[model samples]
Target: MSDPFDLLVIGGGINGAGIARDAAGRGLRVLLCERGDLAEHTSSASTKLIHGGLRYLEQYEFRLVREALAERERLMRLAPHIVWPLRFVLPYDAGLRPAWMLRLGLFLYDHLTRLKTLPGSTSLRLDRDAAGAPLQKRLTRGFAYSDCWVEDSRLVVLNALDAAERGAQIRTRTTVESARRDEGAWTVTLYDSDKRRRESVRARVVVNAAGPWVGETLLRTLSVEARPKVRLVKGSHIVVRRLYEGDQAYILQQPDRRIVFAIPYERDFTLIGTTDVAHEGGPGPVVISAQETRYLCACINRSFERQIGPDDVVWSFSGLRPLYDDDAAANASAVTRDYVLELDTDGPPVLSVFGGKITTYRRLAEHALDRLGPHLPGLKPAWTGTAPLPGGDMDGADFERFLARLVAERPFLPAATARRLARAYGTRLEHLLGDARALSDLGETFGGDLSAREVDYLVRHEWARTPDDILWRRSKLGLRSGRADVARLGRALANPSADPGAQRP
Candidate 1:
């Protein structure tokens, strides 16, 4: 048998990528395998907010709130290009939550974590602000607070990229067929979905962050009975034409007490969502149901000046949260977003992660490694907090300044193109753009602003192996790019020699 890896991470979502990145950075030999492309599941299908779950304050989850809030501050610095500060406008209605209670909650949110960069919350006169102009007349006043927005999928990719650069092996479109414990190590058999090849590797530890299939991975793949059950809660989101004109998002409180967000997306569309409902069936592609679309539209119509219906929904997505079954709350919305790490040290040590959100993923990874301390030899101390992610190591770590430099360096490129590349690739755009000074030098354009140069870069550096991987996950240009563009992009990817620089990692 070959030398065993120090750790093996299953799943490539934010949680798994964060763990692999953390472990690898500490100089541990790591290998992360995913059944599909990175963030092909719940990690990408998020409300894309990095903030303390303000509503969780009602649940009295003070610890979770504080931790998430702190992480929010850290991430804004860590990935400023992909993560930026945003203001959320919460319109007040005396019926849902009283003025006094809302004030107390916002006060707690502002003070729960030390604020160095983000602004604190304050009551606003909605009638005077543009935020109020888009709202219903009844909502005359509200509060505005700070949080961070993320390109959910890109966050996962950057983590995996940083991990790989730090000496971890990332294998996408690969599945662990079986994992059998032998002495102090695990013999894992992996199947490459695309190559139709099978191989086995040895690992001292297996970290299961398979998300919705955590139980299934333990039971079926590891041939062990699943422990610490998970409750699958399905969250759905809907997109529509821009509902209002503003960068500020809305946090509307429903009569049922659940909160929904309406945020700007893709510069031209409004993203609204999400409904919490218990999932009934087994593993499969989750989509927003007609009922969910209607519910979201109704929720938006309740707050926005321009009312919308289900028919107005342009796109929708859904993801299942593999929450650790606490059984403490009967309602899915009330279930804990905090994570639980269970380390089975009986024989071969296996760690399973249950119930976590994107905001707390970094902390989750740190805690996950801490659990394996006794099992790992010479494990390095935690260090991810102070380190910058891939393409995020900009001088001053300022996105706008770095963007100005990119456009300044490549004067031939369009301003919008440079901005998009900077947002998507950050410092790495230089590497992708190479010496190409003109649009013609960047190579053929495949619908929208996507170029062959960028496609080749994704294939070489990022694990973008298919058209869907390029059009949808790597970039959301698929929403605007036509079917013909997709077909052409597929053809472009197939002609490997076309670019000549597209080298697979």
Candidate 2:
């Protein structure tokens, strides 16, 4: 523990985790610390689409859209199990934007990149198309285009897993109490919340990837003076019962000009959301406000034949976006989703990451390392783009084929359980489901298809310390698991030492 780390990344969100993975793979000793579970905030509370931001095109963010579009395909390849193709229907309204303008934007989106696996945008007649059945009769014409859906929280966890695999230290429930530059290196003091102990680590450099708390991390955690450099925008979403029967989703443009997405969720629910409201306070557990809920319901009701009210909302979550304050845009929705990386070379370098979206995290990490390259003499070249994440190196990145093989090997699991495991773990499932011939080997059912075996795997390897981690983050089984089931799982995690094989360290 006395040895100095080459890099210490101070955040467990997508950007921080992605940088740690990239840095570790580049032959640098890395450490990543999070005060809570990974993706427990902005990274998890997303619209859950790996999109090119079709709306941004209106603001002339062509470069951002282009890069995001390219990475959308790369993510599909790099994490096929969690990210997949989704078609979106944008119903035309004469009152909103003219159809000709919509057609032009769609054309630009299609031609933005040279490489794409999805089909081009095409016109749809609501009366003739299955995607149109849920919409009102008045919305007869629309355009359908391509995007990808992601298991947002799992993506963050996978990045940390890959970083850990590449010899980086990932400490969850650890906070950076203070960091100060001394002589030519950074002395970072971390507080282990689990052990209630403090430990100091030496690192050649520090990365402040603390998303919403970027400013606070600088002034309070690192003891540095900085201005109001970031804009805290709050985005919220609502989950309700399944709104439609089809695989397709809808992107409805409201009278306010803000677009809302109503996509299929976790089998039995419809995921509708995302209102961009300005956040004026500190970061914590964000919830959808009454106004946001009403706004979202109104947005959906504009097109869907089935009307909904606030009471229909089964669940809702909110997160704050740490957008770099460019001061050019006034509205939260109009603010750029692009990121800004600041490297302070005043002493031993400390890199600060600000204003980034999930779509471009990989590229951001590469750029981060490139900025710090001068300080670290022997850092290796960029390698994450061509590399596959943990369990992502399947044949042609074909999740369905890999899933079929997994189920074929373990016929004990029900089809639903096997598919869920495959989607969550991919190739990692083989090692997780080790040496069990039937259902009995899985041990202790905790409701749904959640078994003792999966819990052990999550604890031993993936850092599941609570029932909520397993039920909500790693797998969205919380949406289905009953109260009794959750309580039992909670007790199991509370005493990890009870199981002989469960990890203690």
Candidate 3:
């Protein structure tokens, strides 16, 4: 083996990617391995909100809420292109949570964090307000609160990109098959699926941030005999043709005492989610069940003036949340979302992470590094909070001003295409455009405004090897792309030399 790395992170989800970025920025040699494309699982399948869990107040998870609320502000500053403020309307129901209770919860949510970039909560006159136009006539009063929306998967890929730029080796489509401790270090065996080959490397410390597979990675891959503390809770979501005309989202309370969100998505769809059902089966590929589809549809149908059934669901997805099992929750929905980090120092130190949400990922990385500080001496202090991600170096985090400038300079780009590029790449749009003065200069249109130049940029800088990597995660152009577009993209990827913009060393 070559020189041992200071840290080896197993998993490419948000937590893992964040850790790798943090460790690499601290001048430690780091390696991050993922079994599939980055954020292919839970990280990408989030409700995509960067809010303090307003409901967690009922469970008394104050610290988690406070940290998440603060991080929400920091992330907006750090990645202005992909993270922005969102308003949520919570319609009142006399049969459900009392009005005073909702007010109290929103009050705590607004004050929990010191940073206040977004507006505070206020009572809404649903009958008079435009936000109330879509709600059922029976719902006369509601509340409006502030949260932030994120391009979830893109966040993961950007973290990995930043980590790689900071000298961390990010190996996607590579699995850590096994790891063994030898002489105060870990001998890790990785299987690269694309190459169909196995390789071994050494690392002083290993971090297990494998979302749903954390338990299996420890028991099977690492051969650790500790009892797994993770409880698998499956959350599912559905997408349909736009349910409303506004950018605002709705948070609906169900009779079961659980809450669901219906948010405007992708410009043409309304995203409704998230049923928390216990996942009895072991972690693998998960799909939204018929029951879940009905549950979500019913959730929207109950509150919206326009009703929808399962047939209206254009797309659906499910992901398993590996929550830290507190063992006292009455049901899956009640389980604590707080994370627990366990350090096993039997030989080489291995830290296993359990149950963290996307909002608190940065803090989780900081805490993980703090836990490993003793074993790995001379570590730098936390700095991710202040630093910007790869393309988020815009002044004052002013995304709109940056976008206006991009459009002004590249008037050749269609307004929609320019906006999409600015959102996806921020200041990096110049790298992709590269002196192009016309639409044809982008090369090879593949529907959904996706072009050959963009694809090449993704492949070269973002580690995009497949079309799905571009369509779904890198950008949600998949919603607009068809089979023909996918086939064309696949063909383009198959022949790298065909791309005129391919960098020649």
Q: What are the lDDT scores of the predictions, listed in order?
A: 0.89, 0.89, 0.92
Q: Which tens-of-lDDT digit does each residue in 1-505 have in candidate 1?
A: 7899999999999999999999999989999999999999999889988889899999999999999998988888889889998899999976899988888999999999775578889999998988899988889989999888999999999999999989898999999999999977999999998688999999999999999988888788877665648899899998898888879999999999999999999888998978999997886579988888889988987887899988888788899999889878889999998899988776788899999999999999999999998899899999999898878888888999999888888998888788889999888887898889789998889998898889889988898888888877888887789889989988887884744232234
Which 10 consecutive residues of model 3 have the lowest summed lDDT? 496-505
lDDT of 2 by residue, 225-269 (tens): 667488999999999999999899999999999999999999899
TM-score for candidate 1, residues paired by index: 0.98
Listing every candidate in turn, what is its Cα RMSD in Å to the true structure after a full C-alpha superposition?
1.5, 1.6, 1.8
Best candidate, lDDT: 3
Question: Which residue pairs does candidate 2 place in steric collision?
Answer: none
Candidate 2's displacement at residue 390, Å, is 0.9
For model 3, which pairs clash? none
Better of 1 and 3 by lDDT: 3
